[model samples]
Target: MREEYEIYEQSLPWILEAGEIIKKRIQEHTEIKRKSSHSDVVTEVDREIESFLVSKISEHFPEHNIVGEENVGNRVSSSPYLWIIDPIDGTSNFINRKKDFAISVAFCERDRGIFGIIYDVMAGKLYRAHTGSGAFLNDVELNAAGTDGSLENELMAINAPWGSMEEMKRWEHFFKLGTQVRGVRNYGATTMELSDLATGVLGGYVQYYVNSWDYAAGRVILEELGYKFSDLNGDAIDRVYCGGILAASESLHQQIVQSLKESSKEIK
Candidate 1:
């Protein structure tokens, strides 16, 4: 476990270096390619950054398994020590020259994550956390204030795509929650949304679809801050293929889940 913590410490600099590279090239002209849909796209910079990160990890930890967004076509072994990388999350935002994108990384052992890092390249802020340790923004530790947990008084980050049928068929309950909350925001980047949640600025976050790399980093950081995490059905998110996720204070989490359940029963 101590060795794992040491490795976690070593990854911080590598991630920061990647963030610098991202900021330097963010404004340069780049080519974009469509992925599953037109809205889901990838830029050349994304591929380059992913390759660089993978290379760095390979050089230092050759035996560890990696699941990177750009190289998902290749199979990753179910090794106990694994790294999940989203070289440039919110690629569309990055392509549009928006400052809402981020670089997200997570290190895991079997089912337990050791640490997570989300670097907001444009904001020059690094959000990170290790198991049992508190979450942090840059060097300052983050503490959940234990206030503003109510939906009517708290802000939430609910990505716009979640309301679309392609991402979720019966997501109307989520839309209803939006109206109940004090304010709702669509940040286009899960890492930023979850990072804000860790800082207690955003009370909650909900998304209908996300991969392991998408939420893995946020999961570790938010958990360290005592944030509640679970699926829409209020199940534990211990598996890699979590169907969906809801993160908030424990009370707010239950409220959202209970609301969804009632809404579903009405539909039935």
Candidate 2:
């Protein structure tokens, strides 16, 4: 318990400090590089912030394994204590000068995530959680008691690919959910969307493909707030690869999962 709390205590400060670094670079000109296509990109600032975080973590916890989006070195470690990081989650949004970008950091032991932190750099809101400890938005605790129910009356966030015709081949089931909900949102940033879901600002989130660093931290925080998580096929989140993700209340999660299953059969 003491060790867990120590990890939790130091994470917030490091994340907040990273946020400050991100915010300071918002106006300065930075080179952007296309990773695969024009839509998928990275920035010099992303690499810089990631390097800064890796340095800090190595200095403070050399024994811990580090996996970051920008720099993963040559080999991947399967250490029991691992740190997964997305230095700048919404690089496209950041380069486009949107405020929805965020920093996500998660500490996990094997498959169990111990603590997670997501900081909205522009909004100055910090979302954090530790195993068995409730999630918090800054100093305020987020729990089922504090959440607004009325599942049908709530809004949800779906990945952007679900919004189009050509891209909706596999995610058409997800698009159908958007029609039934009160409303739907697409922030193009996983951590930012998940932060809103944990706070009840958004009711749920569904993403067809997301990496460990993309949703790792937000997963811990959301599940702690009584949100359920699974793949579209209703499997546990795969911590290593790009896994389809769904998060919401139990009823909402079931509703979406069942619909996806039924949809697949209908198509066949």
Candidate 3:
């Protein structure tokens, strides 16, 4: 395995360099494309950024396995080093110029995350964390807030799709909890939401669908800050393709999970 600090040190420059490139091209007219559905999207800038990052990693560390959102190659490797990249976490926001997008990158060894970097280009914020090192935003160490899982006092970040569900039961369940929280927000960007969680701006984030690239970097940073993540059932987050995700501080995580479980049962 690569030395902990060395991996972080090597990734920091690359992530910052990539963020610069992305920021420069943010104003350009980039081509947009749909991925799995109309709501699922991608842009030419996404491809360009991923290509640029993959090339840099390949040139510098040819042995590492790269898993990118825009480009998923056929070359599967069992190597210890794996680099996960999400060129743009919020493509819709990027295309619409909404300014909530982010560039996410994570390095893992033997499937264990070691370093995570999430750069909010529009906001000029960078959230980075390594295994033992504390999380930081723009070089300032982040102090995570404590929570005791009381739904009444929590501020939750949930996706917009949940509000438009056809069945009123699930929607009502979510609404009931939504009204009890201190507040509710939808940034349309998972990375930013997770970054906000790390900095204590959000009590937790709930989303229905996200890939490894979307959550890996944020997950590492949150974990370093004494936060936790799991499926709705409170199981370990062992895979990258989980659609339903629940992330929060240790205290709030269980409360959210229990609420979700009860809601799921009710909706069923």
Candidate 4:
């Protein structure tokens, strides 16, 4: 218990420090480079912030392994502790709008989350959680309670994908959900979307694909609020991050999962 508290307490400052670095760095001109595709990108600031965090973690906890978006970390370690970080969750958003990006960090032991922190840099909102303890938006404790569990009354966020047969099929599932919900929104930033979800502003999230750094921290925080996670096909996520993701209340989650599976069969 003490160890969990220590992780959160220590990580809080590190994340805040990283946020400050982001604020200063964004003011200066930042160079962007595309990876895999034009839509997927990285920034010099992304590498800088990640390098900054990696240095801190290495200095403080030399035994922990790190997996970061920028790949600037001491990944080889004998200890079971691991750190996952997305120095900037929305590189494109950060590049274009400069306001929607976030810094996400998570610490885990044996693939189980010890704590997670997501800092909405522009909003100055810090969302964090630890296992067994409820999530929090800064000092305000957050819980998943009193939800109607009705898809019609809830707003959802989706990562829209268009291309290929499988991608289009996933898009169809997203469209189906969009029609049922009160509204659909996209932040282009997973951490921000998740912060809102934890606070009940958004009911669920569906992304056809995401990487470990993209959703790891938010996953830990959301799991604390009774949110259930799974692949689009209804299989348990089990900390898997290289595939589709769905997050919602248990009933709503299963509802979407079943609906998507049924839709897939009929559409093909």
* Tens-place lDDT digits, model 3, residues 234-267: 7887636557788988778887777776766776
TM-score, cand. 1 vs. native: 0.93
**How high is the CA lDDT of each candidate model?**
0.82, 0.81, 0.80, 0.85
lDDT of 4 by residue, 121-198 (tens): 988999998888888888999977444588888888977786798767647867877888899999899888888888
Model with the higher lDDT, candidate 2 or 4: 4
184 Cα displacement, candidate 2 (Å)? 0.9
- Runs of candidate 3 with Cα error greater than 4 angstroms are 72-74, 145-149, 160-172
Best by lDDT: 4
Candidate 4, which segments miss by more than 4 Å at Cα? 145-147, 164-170
* Model 1 lDDT tens row, 142-211: 9863733567888888653534665454666777778888898777888878887888778888887778
Error of model 2, residue 109, in angstroms: 0.3
Instruction: State, as a TM-score between 0 and 1, how close model 2 is to the true structure.
Output: 0.92
Positional deviation of 197 in candidate 1, in angstroms? 0.6
TM-score of each: 0.93, 0.92, 0.91, 0.95
Return whichever of 1 and 3 wins on TM-score: 1
How would the candidate models be sorted by lDDT, starting from the highest?
Answer: 4, 1, 2, 3
Off by over 4 Å in 2: 72-78, 145-151, 160-167
Which parts of model 1 are misplaced by more than 4 Å?
Answer: 72-75, 145-148, 160-169
